[model samples]
Target: MVSTTSKWTWKSPGDETRNQIDCMMISKRYRNALLLAKTYPSADCYSDHVPVVGKFKLKLKKNSKPFTNIKFDLAILKTNQTIRGKNQISVQNKFEALGDAEEVEQQWKNFKSAIMEAATEVIPKVKRKAKQKWMTEEILNLMEERSCSKGNKEKYEQIHKKVQEKCNMSKENCINEKCKEIEQQRKHAPQTMYSGFA
Candidate 1:
């Protein structure tokens, strides 16, 4: 298909000549789904050929599962001493009440049920806070400002730098927080940390 930008995709180093050698191909069945195809001349790729980008519109089917497992927010148990003590006591009491079973399988089932019941009664489920954990309102605002200043090169560059700086800072902070959490887990629950690798 023809590129909308009408820019050459390749250049000769010696002669500085440009050519549209690159092309995008699509299957006949999905050809109509292509919205736009273009070459970006200003892209920072250190190659002879410029990058070709294509936009397409497609309908994706959602596969919903019949059942989903619930995840408990166990971090609360580590942070709150009272809840941790309560959960331990509840599990211990339940185990004591379970008594002896006829078979090993029956004993295991009883123990599992007791733990599940205690967890369900005491622990809270995990809650989704945001789609992107590292993204903040300030970074989003800078991105919006960059998009708005696209027509003005100077303004766009200024905002783009700011956006890059903010994104790097936010990502670094998120990584640092994650590292701290890992260190805490390593110190307090070394077995759990090693179990994750398994």
Candidate 2:
């Protein structure tokens, strides 16, 4: 089959001449899928031959296997002091009771399974929301303003400065709020009090 269009895709540096050395090839079965093919000599690739790019319409197949969700119960270690202590104790006991295996790989796997089992028993799985809870509405507004100011260098810089200031303010506010909460909960053990930071 011949190319749908004629174009020179390459150039010789020594002779200062151009030639169609590069091509965008496709199967006979997907000939209709070739939407556009063109050469760009001024693409700044720093080579003797220019670039030939093609745009094709094709269907992609999805994966057969389901997506695996790996969840870590970090909040249990921070907020649930009782569960944390229990998990730690359980881990220690299981680790100590583990006998030596002939293979280091087997021993490592055993240790991992033991710790996972102990923590799984103590900590409940929680599906966390995919967003930063600390980010304030004011910060969002400033970000929106910055996005709207795109292409205008002066406006972009002004909005970007405002965004930075708002972000700093939001961070300080979150820290101050957490500190106040920790202070209020200071009646409890120091560990639980500082858990607010987590």
Candidate 3:
């Protein structure tokens, strides 16, 4: 009863004592972003190292859009949609999926909107998002790549400008806001992250 706690002793094979031997094998996969955090093993430093693992996806700069084309053999399809003398579409098949003229017109309008959006409107926004996301990820990845993903500097400032331009953000806020982002990614993501733990 005097020394019950230290009384018991255990022993294992020679390989068991090695530092490289991961008990839970957590580091091997170390994919969880939580485990790599500053307070991973429980937020309370006074308490035990609880090992709370948080996982995230860097998304490879394919980032978020935050956010296809098909063509038939032209000849046959045009014949299928040929119109008549009185501006009436002569459908030899007559198996028109369109219910009514108004409906057809509305459908065409909607299609036009979609096409216009794809060709003109949506492309810009999508390009902006794409550019922004890529720049954001690139900045993050660069800082990540260089281990200097934090701070307000000329290079990063230029990056923020580009990203903001794509996102249509105001110049006033881009510097401060974007810097904050850089800091976050730098602090959380490790140098070895891109390469991996294997």
- Whose TM-score is greatest here? 1
Best by lDDT: 1
Residue-wise lDDT of candidate 3 within 5-95, one digit each (tens)? Answer: 2221222454253121112323434345323322132245553223333344443446453422322233433354432221232221122
The lDDT per prediction is 0.83, 0.76, 0.38
For 83-143, candidate 1 gives per-residue lDDT tens digits of 8998998888897799989899999988887888889888887744446789888887777
Model 3: per-residue Cα lDDT at residue 8: 19
True-structure RMSD for candidate 3: 19.6
Residue 30 in candidate 3, Cα distance off native in Å = 13
Q: What residue runs in model 3 are displaced by over 4 Å at the alpha carbon? A: 1-16, 21-76, 79-198
* Candidate 2 local lDDT, 141-167, one digit each (tens): 677678767899999999999888877
Q: List the residue pairs that clash in candidate 2.
A: none
What C-alpha lDDT, on a 0 to 100 scale, does residue 181 get in candidate 1? 74
Whose TM-score is higher: candidate 1's or candidate 2's?
1
Q: Whose lDDT is higher: candidate 1's or candidate 2's?
A: 1
At residue 113, candidate 1 shows an lDDT of 78
Candidate 1: regions farther than 4 A off: 1-130, 194-198
* TM-scores for every candidate against the unseen true structure: 0.34, 0.33, 0.16
